[model samples]
Each structure stands twice: as structure tokens, then as C-alpha cells.
Target: MPVLQRIVKPKTHKGKRAIVNREPKLIEDLKDTLCIKGSTASQYVNNAMRDLYDLKKPSAALLQKKNIILPFEDITPIENFSRKHNAPLFMFVSNNKKRPHNLIMGRTYEHTLLDMIEFGVENYVSLKEFKTDKISTGLKPMLVFNGELFDTNHEYGRIRNLFVDMFHREVVDNVRLQGLEHVLSFTAFENKIYLRSYKVSMKKSGTKTPRVELVEIGPRMDLVVRRTKLASDDLFKQATRKPKELKVKKKKNISTDNLGSTHGRIHLGVQNINSIQTRKMKGLKKTMAERKEERKRKLPQNNDTDNSKKAKNN
Candidate 1:
């Protein structure tokens, strides 16, 4: 699809005389069918058409009245008129004006340009010109120079590109998070900074469960650095040694009330000695009695069997 481009009008104060180059009938003819071909194109033709339709009755702001006050000096009558309207101002630091000095505009906020330079511009364009087909509305812009549409070579496309860059720069910067909290880690590379943060809370198992959150900060943007709340247990462990193992093992069976009546270590020691003696002598006496019974029974059986065999042989 052919991209529709827009020519953004300069913002102006109330009741200021301004001039723009446009034709209501011509713009109406090209409203729906043809595409506005330029680098700073927008897909919303509906919006562009609205701005174009409003241009049918141009604002009094673009009237280009004869007398008005401008902020800067060393300027001609044409410069004075352009300054009255919020026209894009292009100036050259050099005398020839061939090389681009700066493409300035009416102060977005006050009576100042973007670079803070307030010099009266050599050339100016009224918003009316961009809205109408009185001038070319394609790759080559219908330019207003000295209050007239000039078909000759001018810096319209370059100025448009510059304006697009200037406006969209903030949007690109805003892709990074506004601020970060509980950042677990961070990294930095060419023209970019990355941050890693954690979402964590105490778990029921007497352990900490951590969730990771990442952020990116700009390479050039200023940041207010702060310490994270999460403590590093590894660092604490490295600094402090483990406590020595306790020699005492508490007996589970002993009640807290009974613990006071008995001396803990002495009672444990006596019980342990008795347990050892009982284990050693437990099976010895039972084995001796069983052996004696077995010998008596076997002797009687042998005598009976020998007599039976002798009788059979005889």
C-alpha cells in the first residue's frame, strides 16, 4: 500500500497573522484515491483528510498580515512575515546559505527554536500551503519562499526528515522502563544498559523464593542508582564462619518438668553403660541350656537304633 505522508503545521499563538499555500478544490479532488508519497508517511488517511478538510477554511493564523513583531534582528520584510506565522525556519551559519545552518521553528514552548536559537529564518512556509494542492504534495514539497510557492530546489524533504527525527526521538527513549526496583543484576554495552531485578517473598518451607525482573536503562540517560533491599547471603556466609557443633544432644523422651529433677549428662551416661552390658550377655546363657537338652535326646535315640540293626543282622 502507498504510505500517506503528512505535513505538520507549525503551532502558533492566538490572533497572529499567518500565510499558507493551498487550494480547497484541488485537495478535495485528491482526498480519497491518491496516496501521499513521502518518508514521513502515516497510514491514517482518515486523519490526514480531516486536517485537509479543515484547511478548506484556512485559519486566520495564516493570513500573513503586513505588520507584526519578531524576536530577532538583521532580518528582511520576508523574515518578519514568516516569523509572524509559525513557519519552519531554515538558516545558514555561512553567507551563501547553500549549506544548512539549522532548520529552526517557532518555539514549541515559547519564542525559541529547538536548538535555543531564535534568529529570524531566511525562508518560511505557512501551514496553509501544505494542506492544499496549490503546491506539489509529493516527494518534492510545495515550498513557500518569500510568501510565494517556489517550485525550485529547496530543503523541504530534509527539513521534513529532521522534524520527524526530532519528534520521534522521545518515543524511542521511552521504550526503556521509567524506573526499576529490586534489581538483581545489571549489564552495560555500547549505547545501552540492562538491569535485572527480582520479585521475592518468604516461603513456608523456611526458604526464600526469588523471581527475576529485568530492565534496560539508556547508555546516555542519567539514572539515580540505589541499593537493592535483598541481602546477599553468600557474602554474609563468606564473612562469618559456621558456629562450632554442640556436644550435647537433647533427649526427646525427657519432659521439660523432669529435666530439672535429673542431672542431664549424668543420667544419660549411666543409661548408656547399662545398655552396653545388656547387649553383650543377652544370648549366651540361653544357648548353653539348649545344648544340654539336645545332647540327652540324641544319646537315647542312638542306643535304640543300634539294637534294632543288630537284631536284623543276626
Candidate 2:
């Protein structure tokens, strides 16, 4: 009768185990729940740990703070945000995990593994990835990025603090520098960061020195110079004034025939001067003849004339 009574106890309902807790108790293996699913507390802790390990990272485009800039367009080009800065951000589920994760989660993307883990562990994950879109969700485990190009250093502490403080306020206080490991530079202005196996050489042959030259063409300056030149030219023209010509009126000849005595005196004066000029001319001609005779006497005369006379006598 004791052996028959041991076989008589009925099995409890499986749904009764679910009713004990408001949240679903994740059972990894239905076949081996007796061994792995310890107490509810232990299972919760194990699930928490597993969620911590499953971190999600953001795409390089979003991680660069380029996403934060206002007036965002869905078109992803090689220029704009891609050329300037880019980085990868990893999201963990809790404060115990590495880096930091944004706590605010989107309702539309609540079905992903990242949302499930974040919701289960009570935090969201942030990460960086190469292939990222609006549908992207979850915690990424690893990331490759350039430290110098990113706004992660002490200089850009404001931006970094802004992001960290916006997400995990408590965990951000404890985030430590893990020493620079996977550093890269995306300063070449490319939308995507590609790994180069060989060294890329850049020459400064035609590239001019970068500078911001200030050119001045103000209206005041232009007016001043132009007015000065115009004023100077006007003054010069004024200084060299030309004299005006006077017009002489024609007068009719009123007879000098009316003054006989005055005409006679004028004719007499003219005749006296002419007579003096004639006398001087006569004296000049007589003096020239005398000088000609003196020159003839001084010249060596014809010894030929004497020779011809002698030759005729002989």
C-alpha cells in the first residue's frame, strides 16, 4: 500500500512557474533547466552578466557627433560629416560593463536583441559600426577607430562629457582611459575609413600654404581715394588759368589830309634822315676804292711783264 501511494502524486502545471514572476525567466535549455536554471536570483544575475557581455557599437558615421548636428538629411555622401570626423562608440548594458551606453531607447526599435538586453538589464547599448542605418540596434562587442581624429581626448572634453552625461551619468564618472590601441586618422576627408596596407605618400608640389587672406574693398576707402584724385585734378586745372583775348574794333581812316603843317614836318624829318644815309653810303664807297688801291700796290706784281719786255728787245 506504501509503494502504490508513492506513484499517486500529480505533476504541477508548467504555467505556474511563469506566474511566480512578472518578467519572463529566460531558460537557455528546456531540456536541462534543472541543472542550469538555479534559483531565480542566480538566473537573473547570470542573465545580467550575459547581457553585459553583449555590447553594441554605433556606425562610424553616427559615432562622430556628426549625427548631433542639426538639419540632418538621410543621404550619406562622401563629403560633409564623412570628410571631417568619424568614430565608433560601443554600448554596454550596465555600469559594470566597459565604456558608456545611452540610456534613452527608441520605442520603435524595442524588438531588437539590443533592446531586449537593455530592457532586461535596465539600460541601453551604444556602439559604432561600418554598416549602420536607422534599423540598426544592439550592443557591439569590438570597435576600430582613430583616437586623434575623434573628439575623445581632453581637448574635446565638452563634447565627450555631453555624450557621456546624456547617457550613463553614473558610469561616465568611472570610465577610465584604456591606453590608446586601435588609433587611426580619417583626416583625408573620406566618408568611409578604409585600412591601408601600404604607406600613402602625399606631395606638396602644387598645394599652396593654407591661409585666410583678408581683402579690403570698403565703400568708404574707395570713395575717399576717388574724391581725393578728383579734387586734385580740379585744383590743378583751376591753377593754370588762360588769359582772355580782347577783340579790337575797326576804325575808319579820318583824313590826315586835314593837317597840312604836321604832314610837311613829318616829311621833312624823313628826308633829313635819308639824306644822311646817302652821304654815309658815298663815304663808304670812296673808302673801299682807296683800300683796293692800297692792296694792289702791296701785292707782288708781274716780273713776267719785265721778262717779256727783255725778250722782245733781244
Candidate 3:
């Protein structure tokens, strides 16, 4: 099915500017997720989508209960929705007799379905289950992936990258200790992934750094990995491609080390063998006789400079 494009007739200059700003660029803006609820969405799916939308904050877009199947069956509808909303990432929540409490999480590339990983949500817990204060929306949460499989196994590695891509916010050089309010941990064990959310509590210690503690928040779930449609190597490469402008222009013959020290190679041009006065290197070492000759050579030039200065005065 062909994706339809909607044209807006902007009456004001600001509206026109907004339309123009939405066009594609060399460096795209932070990705917004589309939280979709299928026609057969259960309460568990609804709650999960709500919590995910909270994590994504103002950048998330939602769709009401729609009669739609997942990408594994047919990806055209999913692609259409992605193109219409201009969202690269999506979290689809639905339930069926075959795949109960199914959650399809994936990302799009160039309005096409890139990679879709299906998970069966089990042992679901909602946000209201815990009577703790919720972290403010839009604030970045620290994501921790704790699993040996994440580094060893290829499938778990992909899953780790997906979670990081979904939850990570803009890069910042420095963060305040107080600003770390929440942490989301994805732990893989016993053939299932455990998703846990915690509120960071900072207490006063007798030192400069505060005593930190983690309090259990809600919206937790144990996800059983089901079907997965991974993109090919070439396609995945295209999706993860970075613009040249975004890459730092490297300085020639300069490098850094693990200890964070900047090292550079100094390229020297041809030097005049007679001009060097160093005696440290054997090739440039000056004998006593050579030193005497050098002083004698400088004496005449020094006298000439003094004579020129005197002539200028005259």
C-alpha cells in the first residue's frame, strides 16, 4: 500500500516554518516513539504502553485501539503508520489466543520496518501497583543492562542495543548528582528478561558524596522472547549509519590514549645541518673545535649587527 502524504495549508508564517522544519535533514532530531494499541489490546498491554509513553514523554505519539496485525504477519500497515506520524520507533501492545500479552517492540528505517522483536509479557505489574511517587516524565533515566548473554550471545546483544536506543536521551557532558532520580534495569536470567524500575534515593552521608539507595518502583514485567524479525546486515548498517557532519573531524597525526592524554606526532621539515647547536644527539653533537668555530662565526655577525645599529644612529 502506498503511503499517503497530507498537505497543510499554513495561514501564518510560524505555521509555515514548522512545516518546513519537519523536512528531512543531515542530522535528524531525537526519535519519537509511537505507542500503538491493537484492537485486541488487554489491560496489561494498555498499562505497558502507558508506562512506555511516560518514559518517552512529549516525543511519544499514541493511537487508539486499531484493527492491525503485527509486522511478522504483514509490515505494510506498520510502515504506513510510521510514515504518517514520522516516528522511527514503535511499541505495539496487543493480545491474541496464540500469543498472549504480546508486545511488539521495534524501530523503522526510512519509513520501513527495520527490526521487530516480539515478547510475551508475563508477570506484569502496573505503575499503580507500587504506592511510591513516580519520577517526573521527560527526565532521562539511567538504563542498566545486566546479563552475561548481552555481551556473549548475538541475539541478546541486539536486544541490548535496542533497549539502549529506545531509552537513551541526548548526550550530556555532565550530570548533577541530584538529577539522577530513576533507573531502569533489564536483567536477563533463566531464559526470561526481567524489567525493573527503581527510584534513586540520595541520603546525607558524613562525606562529600551522598549515600545512594534504590527503591523499587512499579511497571515491572518479565518478558519471554518470542518471534523476531531482524534486519539484514546491509539494512541494519544503513539504519545505524551516521552523517559525516556528525562525526568529529580528526586532526592529522594526533591521537589519544587510554589515560586520556592527547598525543600528536610532530612533522618536521628538512633542517639545515649547520644551524643546529644541540650536542645531545650524536648526529648533531658538536666537538670542542666545532663550538669554537661556531662562536667565531657568531662574533663577526654580532659585530656586523652592532656596526649596522651604529650606522643607523649616525
Candidate 4:
């Protein structure tokens, strides 16, 4: 009997955005089967594409308008509008230098401006500092909290409390937060806190556990602590300080004057006596000389006498 083979259908697309090819007959069959009307196949294709891409319609939270204000000349904008709208206003500095960007968010315009100054932005003039002539000199588009989705009074207070609580609990407990000597910074996302401490770690082992040994002092650590604030400044300082130097007792040197003492003479005499006894015992021990003497005593003076007597008899 002949072996049978089954035909496999070709897939229309692969990976994320790859183009898919479909049989012309299959497309026509789908249209006819669905009783699609008119030449508007584009709409049907669009809906199918949306389903294939797993895209969902924007929710009310995302659709809501945000309070977008312009920043001062020394400040920059944070393009993450979604995250900005949800949490308390804070400054976000990008880690990437090639795409340098900074963002400030706060409950009010004044609060955000104050934070900018606090975080080392120089020559920043507040709104009051600006004369009517200089009003537009430093202005740029910046995002502020819009009261649509987030209530200014309640939400701002909540965000502030959340930040303070997280800082005290997560950062203070786990890391040494030193005053002036160390810098502590944090970022909040969703319900989690990303706490970072810049201080010398004295741990000697290369493993991940924190240590206090001076030999193990390591570079800065960027840690992600949970929402609960466990870190404290005092605790961190106590843990990371340089360990005390170990004191080793020095060995006492022997005096040359004691070399000729009675005890030393006695020890030398006992050693000499042991050497004489060892020398005497060595003679009594079985040796090659003793074996040669015994062999001569056992062998024949009789053999030579017997040989001489035999020769006389012959």
C-alpha cells in the first residue's frame, strides 16, 4: 500500500510584527463565510490585527487629562506621563547620559520648584522672582498633578507619607545612612520603593551579604527594599565603620647573658651524657664487622689441614 501524506496549512505571521501571508482562497472563504458586505475589508483586517496584537482599549485612568506645566530653564521634563500621574511629585534623573532627561513632580507648582532647588539645580528663580519682562525667559513644558484623577489634598498627602515611611523603614533598617558622609536617594514606582545608599561597605567577602570588615569594603550598592521602611541612619553608621586594629603580643627575646647559666650547663651536660651512651650502645649492635669475624671463626682451619693430610696420603 502507498504511504499517505497530510498537508499542513501555512501560518500567516510569526513573532511580534512580522507580515503574514494567507491563501487568496482562504481570505475569500472567510469573507463569504462571515457574510461580510461591501469592499470594506480593511476594517475587518484591522479588528483581526488588533486581536492578534493583544492590544486593549485605553482605560479611564489613562484617557484622563493631566496637569502639564512648563519647567524653569534649569529643569527638564519626565516623559513617563503615566507613572507621573499616579504618584507624588519627585525628581527623576535618567541614568543614561546619551538620553539625558530629568523630571519633577509634586502636589503643587511651588513644591516642585522647591524640590528642584533642593536637588542642586542652581540659578533657579521661583515664580515670584520673575518680573513680568523675565516671565517667559526660563519657562518650558513640565508635568504637574492634574486634579482630575488624583485629588490634590488627599493624594498628595498620601504620596508624601508613603515616601517618608518607605525611606525610614526600608532604607534605615537595611543600609547604613550616614550623615553628610553618605548620600541616600530613592525612587518610587507602583507600590514599591527603589532605595539606594551611597556609602562604603566594609564587608570582606565577595558574596552578597552585607559586612563590616574593613578588608571587604566595597563600592556603592543599589538595593530594592520593599515598601516597609527598615533602614535607619544610626544602624547603618554602626555597621559600616572601620573595625578596630588588632593588637598582637610581641615575643620576648632571650638574653645572651643567660647562655652560661647553671641550668644551661646542666642541660649541656645531660646532652653530652646521652651522646656517650648512644656511642657505647652502637658498638654492641650487630654490624658487618661482627658478622665477618663470626664467619672466620666458623670456617675451616680444618679444611687446609685435611687437604695437607690428603696430599701426603696420595
RMSD of each: 29.6, 42.3, 9.1, 27.2
* 7-104: candidate 2 lDDT, tens digit per residue: 43335665454334323223211110000111122333333333222211222122211222111121122123222222112222222233122111
- Identify the runs in model 4 with alpha carbons over 4 angstroms from their true place: 1-69, 72-84, 92-314
Q: Quote the lDDT for 44 in model 1.
A: 31
Q: lDDT per residue, candidate 3, 1-314, as tens digits?
A: 99999975999998788778678788678888888888888987788879878778888888875766766888888888888778888998888899988898999888888888899998888888899888987888999989898888878888888888888787789998889998999999866899999999989999999999998887899999998888888988888888888899989999999999999899899999898766677777778999999899999999999999999999
Q: Weakest 10 consecutive residues, lDDT, candidate 4?
A: 28-37
Error of 4 at 62 (Å): 16
Candidate 3 Cα errors over 4 Å, as ranges: 1-19, 267-314
lDDT of 1 by residue, 120-175 (tens): 12222223333322321221111112211112222222223222322221112332
Q: Could you estimate the TM-score for every candidate?
A: 0.15, 0.13, 0.79, 0.17
Task: Give me the runs in candidate 1 sitting further than 4 Å from their true place.
Answer: 1-60, 68-71, 74-105, 115-162, 165-314
lDDT of 4 by residue, 1-314 (tens): 99999965546445212213221221111100001111222332222222211111121121212233333343233223323342213322221232212222222221122222111111222222223221111111111222222343433334444334222211123423322222234443443323332333344478876464211111122222211212244643543244344334543542235456332222233356554644357557878987899889867786888899999999
lDDT of 2: 0.25
The best candidate by TM-score is 3
Candidate 1 has what TM-score? Answer: 0.15
